[model samples]
Target: MKTVEVQNLIEIGLDGAEVEVSDPQGTGDHFAATVVWSGFEDMSLIQQHQAVYKTLGDYLTREIHALQLKTSAK
Candidate 1:
């Protein structure tokens, strides 16, 4: 899971969300991302994470070994 690929997936799934992803451990499988989208405003912290997870779909635990997500509203 390259950073750009992850960013693209999130952006597309979240309806053009702004995402910044980094490979913290220099391993493509371990990533950290910060996402900003208007949809997050009414969602709780857990819900926010779930929304991102939904975007990633099956890639969450499979392709992406770990994702540290920080989500915020635009």
Candidate 2:
């Protein structure tokens, strides 16, 4: 998937989240995303990552081969 599509998906899924997605290796399957959202305030690191994973759903392993995620509470 393209970076814009990834960013849009995350932004929509996380509501008011600020999302930035990039293809670091210029490979369509590998992506890096940074997401900032208030929902992560009290969540653990694993939970934070899980939230992103959940947002992507089936698209995770299928369309996206690998995702490097950075998440923070705003």
In order of appearance, the predictions have TM-scores of: 0.94, 0.96
Local distance difference test scores for all models: 0.92, 0.94
Q: Show model 2 residue runs off by greater than 4 Å.
A: none
lDDT (0-100) at residue 27 of candidate 1?
Answer: 83
**lDDT (tens digit, per residue) of candidate 2 on 1-74:** 89998998888889999999999999898999999999999999999999999889999979999999999999
TM-score result, candidate 1: 0.94
RMSD of 1: 0.8
Lowest lDDT sum, 10 consecutive residues, model 2, at 4-13
Query: lDDT of candidate 2 vs native?
Result: 0.94
Candidate 1 wrong stretches, greater than 4 Å: none
